[model samples]
Target: MCDWNVDPEPSKEKKGRLARARGNLARRHSERLLAELYAGGTLRARRDASAVLAFAVALVVHALTLAVTAGGIWFIVRGWGGWGMVPGALLLALGWSLRPRFRQLPKDTPVLRRAEAPELFALVDEVAGTRGVDTIVVNDWINAGVGSYGVRGRRLLVLGLPLWEILSPQQRIALLGHEMGHYVNGDTRHGLVVAAAYRSLITWHYYFEPGEHDPLDEAATLQLIVDLLYVVPRLLVLGVLTLLDRLSMRASQRAEYLADRVAAQAASTRAALEWMDRMLILDSAAVTLGREVNRTSLNRPRGKQQTDAWAKGLWERLAADLASVPEREHERLRRVGALRAHSVDSTHPPTHLRHACLQIGEATPPAVVIDDERDRRIAEELADARTKVALQILQDGY
Candidate 1:
């Protein structure tokens, strides 16, 4: 069985020793690889800032519109019934108070039943125990969309669908290792603080801002108006959050690198990196295929099997051709134009970018292979066991 038990009272020195051991186990060029990972994190932070700026501009424009409209509101509300402007203002204020800072944590968080999968819990606990840190709390939730989040107090929000798809046992270990790095590095706290600040700003912009009032109506009309208004500020906040997310993603990428390094030290960074690359490729392929299916369904002509067959056949051929290529070839096959086609409106970076990061020597230095045979055997065994455990948990007679 997988070793899930961790001593709750591990020391700092012990934690450091374990980390070093893990790092060296892969025999990678530790110093250089670490630098590259840190640098990538910095880049992600910059991108997150860009997203925030976009949201900020939108918020300002909204405020100005509200200000201009507010002047005429005095005239408009001169003889209105009901509670005059008070009720409208109150409701608007209340709605703003509840707006999410970033979109709800990715949607799939709820689906990955962590409670059922005991090994996953043990895995996280082991890392935390080794680090001499409190075990990060893991919970499942279906967020705005499917995604996981690391919060303060060593808390982890795992999206059900995303987790189900993302990693193998070794890769999952590496991913968890990366998350532990965030906890170790205080990133979880940073994320929460940033989120809180963004929430506060959004609350202020929506509720207290004098410019946001409806002119003749006293309140913003339509759900869209409220949505739009919220979007601007929230988007601004999301922009910031996105920036931070990118930063976090970058940080996450770094953490991935580090975890790979640790895994490499223990086994093979190449294997870990390769695993990550495959996972990303699969995610991108799934997204692309889903989009195609959705668009086809939406635009399909109102007809039966005969009319749909030709178009369906054409799409099938195209999909088959695309799917025929190896996952590693996604970057090579994806054109800049084609990349644009895929970039409808995703907060996360492009598939190629993720793919590019997964490539060794872009920023990461060369990793040394330890006992490849041993590592391979252990990885396979762990993976098979986890898969069985995960499957049983999923299929449990509830």
Candidate 2:
């Protein structure tokens, strides 16, 4: 039977080779920059006045957008003819859409208040130093982050319960120290001007990005014209993005290194090292957790699914799964990270470089410690949310 309806997808490995080049370049750049900074024997990066160029470019982007927006208004007002209004409307729509937007915490994220988790807040306040955290939130994932959100730039802390459950108390403090470090270190990539400019270029690139189109489709010749028109603009947007990235990224990577230093200082060298070890096994941990959940769900009746002990025992099983991974596997993971200069994302430097940098520095004792009594008390505060998250994970089939 001939399957004329089927079109086998292109090989991902083949496509990835070409498509991943840009990311590969960025990673190499990160490695080089980290090496250079470390060679200077300084953990902290001094402010670079040259960052003003990035800010200037950002202003230019905003000015261009405003000019286009004004031109759109002029076109509509003059209305060269009745149908002349069409181009005006299109231009207006595009210019307006390209404007930067304020970030807000996701609606699905569960927000925790100080009253609800005072002990958790105390730990956060101590680690954060000045205590500007506006809200704390939790989710089911195995990651955590801190970010500014809302018009006033209120700080939001995201705690991933799965990862939190696996971490020791000091490791938890280390994690908090790292995130708070981003803010205190003053990572310039997140600054309003450069960040907004970068955002505009990304949007522009998306609008002009080329894609496969059928020649036999309606108005195919017009589509070809459109594709041709997109090429130059798309290239320009890409070039600008590259420029902005080059200007802002060095500072960002330095921030990451500095944050690691802060983590070590706050939670002790041992705790920070253990924290890094956990990072290396994140992929394996996620896979094991997923397998466990799937196995638990298998052949279990929907009605009786609620009777499952997910809330009571999922974390224990997950921790055991991670603990069982061989030390040789951990070494292998480190080698892989070193080979590729692995990072959590384009925004971070290579994780292995970070870990190695910490090892060579002086060992420090933890400034803050969470004792058994306090740890248990914090857990008591988290009991309701913990059970709810576990039930939700089970019901939602994660």
Candidate 3:
């Protein structure tokens, strides 16, 4: 009377249409939210939503873990020698093993001080304004950010020295203003909680893996049972993690937009746009240049000075190449779009989109100017510190 079988697949065109519709919907939703946020008075709501979601996820995870542990204990007490006890004991052990560990903030990079680089320190102070920065560190990479560190919870402003070398004085000020904006907006506080939750989910997922053997190695029936037991639970946990991660990422992107607006106010909108564009170009070039440097560095045993010189030369060449690109070619480059596309998991918007937003904001003068004398002084301040940092990099063979 009734058909039990059903079609298991959809047409490819149907699937494509559904995917496009979903993409359009999501894009429209994000645009509306961004518009409201930029118009003002929505950041608090976004922050609250992020916090509540993070808290809810944490609560559910902990409650599930506790319930499993309690059930395990009950089985152990009621039937100590039975098969029920075995699973109960295993569940308890799993819960215990997967408990989140206190994470340590990494501290391998060199810390720069006001005494060592007064000019740079003065520049930082001017950019930072009233913000409190506990430490200033130089990293070897081509990105910069602000974050809290260690048990003492010191606020750190980490500058990528290489990126610093590439940017003009005004661009550097725009970058610093953007980073300080994170502190001003209380993003770092919310960020810590979200980061902890993400780390916990990641840890749980890792614990769900079948260790040292494939479930398929067993007989078909046993393998089926194992798959039903392990695979299903893993997928459920992964789904929850994906949902929570996207929520956190959306909050982060909002924070980035707000920070960009702050940069537009504190520094020049034009400088902010220029900084982002230069960063996009540098990021693309860094990958190829980094690979070449890595290969070349490994082939020879060189002193710190020599290594530094080689790295500087490579950077200079990369900069030269960027500068030599024609204006028309630069326009073509934008057609490829930003280095990273806007996505659910991405923390930053696309460069073009950021530029568009800044264009709508009121214009401001450049926050800082670098004359030849000022540039020379800044260079001198970094000279010794750069050598030391270079030596460290060479010693680490990176």
Candidate 4:
């Protein structure tokens, strides 16, 4: 992911001890990589031995899916009318689902076209230094980023509405700048082969993942046997994931530093610094996005009309809520972030380090400024989208 994936808290399922331990390890790994990179002053055109091995491992994972597919086809062809058909059928289904491929945008993904959002596209273009992105989109989130989608090398811009609604015009530019910067830097995770490989492993891991509870009619002993059988394979897959993550993230941390440098150029050093500052409290927006809708619904607006009004004003309410946050709270978040090394993920460098880097880096004027005219037009363009997202949030009750 190009961004902190929105700085949301780890999902409930991922809050287990194993996950926390993994996260802490990732944090430490990123920190060490950042320090090493900074000290080496080798910002670009460097790939360590481990990175090459990781690439090879990624291809192996990708090919394993293909191998499963081939094994299925062979069994089906060789044993057309025999007992082999049962396992063949299962393997076919599993292998097909596990195919390595780019992350395709959902058919229902809400998109903004150049024609529909000229002002917004103008800002995007400016942030990108006239580079064209394949898509600009919105979703229910408190984050934003640029990522590649599909095998054709198309780039996507996804703005988290809650994040967008709260940002200043310049901050918005900074956000786009940072994400766009990822394309310029060496974001190995965006690579088709590597990304697809990682995703395939994730799917495989999830598929064979042992259920916390057995099926109602299943025998416990049988389930235990099945689970025990999968334990070794699952552990092996997880180990590969950890190794790949560690290797790729070293480069990813360096890329983050480079992207921040680009962000500084795209939206000024001051804006980039402010961007890091805002990153510390992204959790607040995520929390508010969840609570605002549920709290409003709980308030029990009398009828459809009242509910619709509340939904329409959702962004305004969210913005106001953020505006009222005290500086002390901001400082507190910064402290907490520092304690955790201030990471968005294991891959990205800690916010404190990036912030300090920018503080001491060059100062520049913003390439694209967000004035009242620009802000008003972009907001007008996204008005329906904002309302729709609000309604979706209300409907989803999150």
Which residue runs of candidate 4 sit more than 4 Å off their true CA positions? 1-22, 36-42, 45-49, 107-109, 213-218, 298-308
Across residues 87-144, which tens digit of lDDT does each residue of candidate 3 receive?
A: 8888788767655444344567667666777777776667667644767788666778
Each candidate: RMSD to true structure?
A: 16.5, 6.6, 9.1, 5.0
lDDT of each: 0.40, 0.77, 0.63, 0.76
Pick the lDDT winner. Answer: 2
In the range 1-398, model 2's lDDT, one tens digit per residue, is: 34332323322333233225445655665677667656865656566864777778888998888887888888899896688699899889988987777887766657788889999988888887778477887888788888777888888888888888888899999999998888878677777767887777878887887666787888777878898999998888877777777776677777888888889888998999889888887877778767766876784535544544555577777788788888867776666666655677657767887887777646989988999999998998887777667666756766
Model 2 lDDT on a 0 to 1 scale:
0.77
Off by over 4 Å in 2: 1-29, 32-40, 215-219, 301-309
**Model 2, residue 126: displacement in angstroms?**
0.6
Rank list by lDDT? 2, 4, 3, 1
TM-score, every prediction: 0.40, 0.87, 0.72, 0.87
Tell me the tens digit of each residue's lDDT in model 1 across 1-398: 22222223322333343234333322232233345644764322223453354445445534644553563355337625645566556544544554334433334222233344444444555644453222222222111111234433434434222242344445554444444544444222134444454455455544523344455664546543656666566555444433434333333334434434444333245545554444434435455435545555566545555434533343244345444667436443344313332211222233334334445453443232224564455334334333333322222311
